[model samples]
Target: MSAVMISRKVRKWEKLPGKNTFCCDGRVMMARQKGVFYLTLFLIIGTCALFFGFECPYLAVHLSAAIPVFAAVLFLFVMAMLLRTSFSDPGVLPRALPEEATFIEMEIEAANGNVPSGQRPPPRIRNIEINNQIVKLKYCYTCKIFRPPRASHCSICDNCVDRFDHHCPWVGNCVGKRNYRYFYLFTLSLSLLTIYIFTFDIVHVVMRSVEDGFLSALKETPGTVLEVLVCFFTLWSVVGLTGFHTYLISLNQTTNEDIKGSWSGKNRVQNPYSHKNIFKNCCEVLCGPAYPSVLDRRGLMHEDSPVSASSAAPSSSSSSLSFSNNSKPAPPTTKTTAPLIPNEHTPDDAKASIGVSAEQSCSPEDLPPSFIPPLASPETDAEASVAKDNSH
Candidate 1:
């Protein structure tokens, strides 16, 4: 097996900056942080395993076969929807190109010309009319574009998602237009599965209690207690989630819109996306055509470095840039540099003399008479003066 192994190939999703973990060469994608998701998987698998392994056989033989059959089908559906919701793309929008970003920036600057110094700039928002309703689009600095209507940035995922809904930790994915249907189905099926398991576990225990006494029944089938506990706890959350999502589907609103009071507020803004008919809205939300993933996680990336994306974009008016000029290489300029020479005339007094030689002192008596002091040659001078007087 080691000798027959093949190296994994790098794909486009490997270079993506979004906060998602890609596995199996970009085929499986999920949130980067999925600690809760693992627990969710464990509980689901553990409870179902306990039910099928311990309680299902007894219930099928003694009670009814349809219980196990319906349970298995519901469990399979739940798991399928869970994986589909977790692994599928959540309608993530690609980041704007540097040129596009710069063009937008230039437009913003042009619109807001000559702003006073030391004043805060107004929020970057664009309002567009949708079905007679004004929808505000906010700028996403990270993605470098104004988000589309019903689209928003997920701080956890660090990606702008279309028809954005809240991120679900249990599913380990952001619930958005692409995967919300799967998520809704997952919650619905899971709730049904939990309720079924809980109901049967109690019934199985009661049957044992009737035949072998209640205490003895619990002792013989200890797994029933665990399964019951698991299902009982999970049942409420899944059911509540299912109902809440059902309401949202009917209204044709996202979790984000509902939370932000996009429709119900003091402003009394109506939902622009709604079809006005409850049946139509439900059908549109749950039965509409699924949108394709735009990120193209498995597609080959363009053979260009990421640094090249924004390097050539001008400071302003980037949309009007000439691609032909940008493609041409600029002429190179040559430069000459003179070598440095040390100064020879600089003073050498910076260094102290290690040792000094002693100077000789000459005595006055060793000098010639004319050069001598008068006191040293006093006697000789008197004798010469007497001889001169006799000659006169």
Candidate 2:
């Protein structure tokens, strides 16, 4: 059996600024951001509790209410953290890309070793037909073939990611095609929890005002102060998070997609994914059934499905194919593995190396400049010929 080149690095779980300590995977910052938010919430909650005890000399009556509210908030916090952990780990949908696509231009220092002076360019990528669609893709010089959609060459991971989401440091994981659902659910639940806490605290403030008499409520019920504190924190979290997510939902986009504008249809003459109603697009993404599920393909493909083969523009190259029909109601691709690199010592490469023979479709003369050897000068050739005569 041929020796296959598998990734040898450990998957990351955390990252520090300027340090390659964690995954170093180029995914999102959900886990890290959530940590900061959780910390702020804890401090706010503590401060409110402390202030409430100070103001209200008699807290006996409402102490029971405080216990349950606090418990619920704590539960939500723990649940969110746990959910984040599972979601950020290796996702269910595995990554798939051609081995050759991962070979990028590297800046090697002179200290490394003696080498050629000029820079090496990435190999010419080729498009391939998967299912039937033409997909544009890069050919990994080392690995080889078409990678999965959204798959990207991660400089840190030193490989390509299929449906690449951002690398998350907090969980030391890559958010790819598989764990997307968990990631989305975690956000949704956290948002709901924030809103829930905000509502209760606000209501508690009103209740305190009524029972203790609004005129002297400040002194009569000090716990009301704590309620207000929780209210602000929860409200802020809900508003900020919900607003950001709402916009993403409306466009059926992801944080990465938003950043990259992969689905913006910016360069294209017409935005195929642009929908008549935002809700219609959102509904399909969140509740409808589809490979792209509306959200995935929003910026990439037209929504209502291409009318015919000619209607959908053919991919510029074979690497960009996406099967012929986007609306075929087909299941997502199950084959999710990167292509393998060919052995250097194999007969195929050996034959091409010595100019003895050429591989099919790959002419040696047409190889890129970097792959060609430097020409020998006339003076060096004459010396070599004289040395051979002397030896004889």
Q: After superposition, how far is residue 62 of candidate 1 from its true place, in Å?
A: 1.3
lDDT of each: 0.83, 0.48
Q: TM-score per candidate, in order?
A: 0.75, 0.42
Best by TM-score: 1
lDDT of 1: 0.83
Alpha carbon lDDT at 54, candidate 1: 88
**Alpha-carbon deviation at 92 in model 2, angstroms:** 8.2
Please name the candidate that would achieve the greatest lDDT relative to the true structure. Answer: 1
Off by over 4 Å in 2: 1-124, 128-135, 139-146, 153-161, 167-174, 213-227, 230-234, 269-392
> Model 1: how large is the Cα RMSD against the reference?
17.9
User: Tens digits of per-residue lDDT for model 1 on 129-157?
Assistant: 99988889999999999999999999999
Shift in Å, residue 25, candidate 1: 1.8
* Cα shift from native, residue 188, model 2 (Å): 2.9
